[model samples]
Target: MSKKTEFQALDLISAYSEKKKNPSHLELNQIFPNPTQPRLIGREDTADLVPSMERLGLIEPILVRKDKGKYLIVAGERRYRAAIKLGWKEIPAIVTDANEDVCYEMSLAENEKRKNLNPWEVGKAIQYLRKEKRKTAEEVSELLGYSGRYVKQLSSIARLDQKSVMELMISGKPLSVKNLEELLKRKENRGGETISPRPGSGSGRISINLSKLNGRVRDNFLKELGLLKKKYGINE
Candidate 1:
């Protein structure tokens, strides 16, 4: 096996060993190390997770690092938060080797599996892997088990304005992935040109026909759609 594979196997073994050592122990002594790095965002739905943990307990262990007899949580912030909310004194966690690059990769993988991360968070993760870990975008995508084009698309989404993002979150529109791509393209064009759409262009229309868009032109089209919505009271 490669070094990476060996490390992963050992990590899993250590996790299993820790779990088997004390099946009923609750005073988990690990102090989460990377507390500042949040793997999950949008606390609006956190209440839902709490009850599940409270009922069945944490099914998965958090990843952590040890420092001075304290384990710092590296990933699984949501699980930790839920545990705290449910009044659990101790939670399960996996102690892994202190490889910053690998830790980051694992963190991203963990989050990617559990929830649909926002574009900004995904972009930040990708950026961290590239800038801090010196991994190429393609390499990062490969590590995350995502396609290179998918990674590039996520990076592009990260560059959208907060207003546009808010629109996406609040409008409750049936926005397909293709629609989001079109919206992003529109935002990019608006940045280049000072052209603003006439007021009341889209009238709050939610559904967009992505097939009509052709590269950069789609950006202008979305801006016009937003303007139309602002002008008219279309609740789509």
Candidate 2:
């Protein structure tokens, strides 16, 4: 997230959405945040933006997409949060009808420009696009206009477990993609560690026949399955 990359999010957004940005002062209630966007760490997070906003009065408009009756933030969650902290009922925005891919593209591009986004956030965002939006690595690469090697590095970041990555983040040690990649690989990144591969990446799966088991065994299996689902927050 340092130094401006060649990625042009707005251009791609215009291409995919084919809709002009409708600038408006939207009520905070009318807008929602992007789930895949990085989380803000409280006053400290908005501390920087708040002062600027107070002085400049929102020089830039946040990007958003209409969903249901509300607007979902496609980019600029940091600014949106700062406005909320300032008790702003209305903030400027550019609302669009962009699909998920376009929204994601803008998000990544904005992150590249801002340079505040961390490696963990980038990993999770990529993982979200892969799982929730069903985007392939190649498609993601093309969307960001990034090279395959760079996208592959990011996909590798997605492989490390959350706890471990968080620990490294807490250490506040600067980590290069290559260094983190190798460190995490010492455990899981040899291939796919915690991350599930792209849907078509492989045919690996597991199946069991509960009917073949006696009642007691089936009951025990189901109990374990229930526990697993709870641990992983899987919906029944």
Candidate 3:
């Protein structure tokens, strides 16, 4: 995260105090995830949170909106999940009347500062705001107060294959921006096909387009590909 982003996130955190005019308790089972939430709650990421929440209680109240008869979570999902795992019947929440658009804005604001989103998640979030909210990449960039290039990079990451994404999310591999760039390059160079498994297949088949090459040439190419994968830390 950039310094500017850090400051913006702090600004939103401070805004929480200003808008926290109504703090009350709601049944844990009554709260549902916002339909437009972009953040993915992974078990690995939230495992330690349960223990911390048990020891400290909830430091900040979750932001929620009343929908139908149930409450919809606007932000603080990690904390909310922690509270649930701790067997809390009721949890502290700040009820707000913000509409869906405003709720999504607040969710993004909180996520930007938290710095917990992986690159794929960041890309997907950017894409989600563009399509769901009908905002352009430039507009989302402005909303984030980030550069257009950064927005484009995330757009690229969002296009990665589901298999690659699943591996990245689960493997505990460090995906630097440079690694993301290389992945994008490989994707683009293939013109449409990727090394990932084909969709809708029970067995994930890695399709290599070697029909045009002879056996000797294909053998040499495979040798070089193995070396490249190791250099890039791409697990087979």
Candidate 4:
């Protein structure tokens, strides 16, 4: 929920908007996960979701694609996992004929909507699209609702390694995007003697993500925090 970059969202995979098909009860054994799932970079804990599912029973159906007589999860792997853990033999799903590319986009969009994806994980995915020229700068800008320059700036972070991404994921922490970007910039321009955004580094700064909050709520929260910071003589 890192505030959606403000894209006019389209149902790329039609998972949410597909009106032609009703949810089908698919056997848990039949669905396999998409191997290239971007989530593989920083798999999240679906433990919290499990209890909710157990109590309420899946509130939303998962999205899946049928391929080669097997169902591949386009998104909602977390829901599927919870269902598995609950010992359910079958789960409800909306089956779509999304191909590999559409599946990837839908997975990214769904995870993003959940606000669970690490910023770096998103950067890597953007970089992958750019490197392959599958998406141009304009297309990316339109898709993300970010300016071309900003998208390029964000994508530059993909140069960072998976270790850092994993560390953030493990700690459930968000780092200052600007700080990380500046560090990367310096690394490229000035073969920095020591480049680290982890605690040991002097430049390290933690960030609070407000994307999941409603816009007005996040604004009010930030305003209150600013007042508190001023009252406490806190420095940026």
TM-score of each: 0.61, 0.67, 0.71, 0.69
What is the lDDT ranking, best to worst?
Answer: 3, 4, 2, 1
Model 2 RMSD, rounded to 1 decimal = 12.1
Q: How does candidate 4 score on lDDT?
A: 0.70
* lDDT tens per residue, model 3, 28-100: 9999877677675462366878888899988788999888999999888878878877889998898878777
Give the residue spans of candidate 2 off by over 4 A: 1-4, 8-10, 13-22, 38-44, 189-236
As a whole number from 0 to 100, the lDDT of residue 154 in candidate 4 is 65
**Model 4 regions more than 4 Å off:** 1-4, 13-15, 18-21, 41-44, 168-173, 182-236
Best model per TM-score: 3
How well is each residue in 78-141 modelled by candidate 4, as lDDT tens digits?
Answer: 8888888889999989887667776777777777677656656677778866776478877877
Choose the strongest candidate by lDDT.
3
Clash count for candidate 1 is 18
Sequence-dependent TM-score of model 1: 0.61
TM-score, cand. 4 vs. native:
0.69
- For all candidates, the clash counts are 18, 1, 0, 1
RMSD over all Cα atoms, model 1: 11.3
Candidate 2: tens digits of C-alpha lDDT, residues 74-115: 877889989999999998888867786677778777666666
Q: List per-candidate RMSD values in Å.
A: 11.3, 12.1, 10.2, 13.7
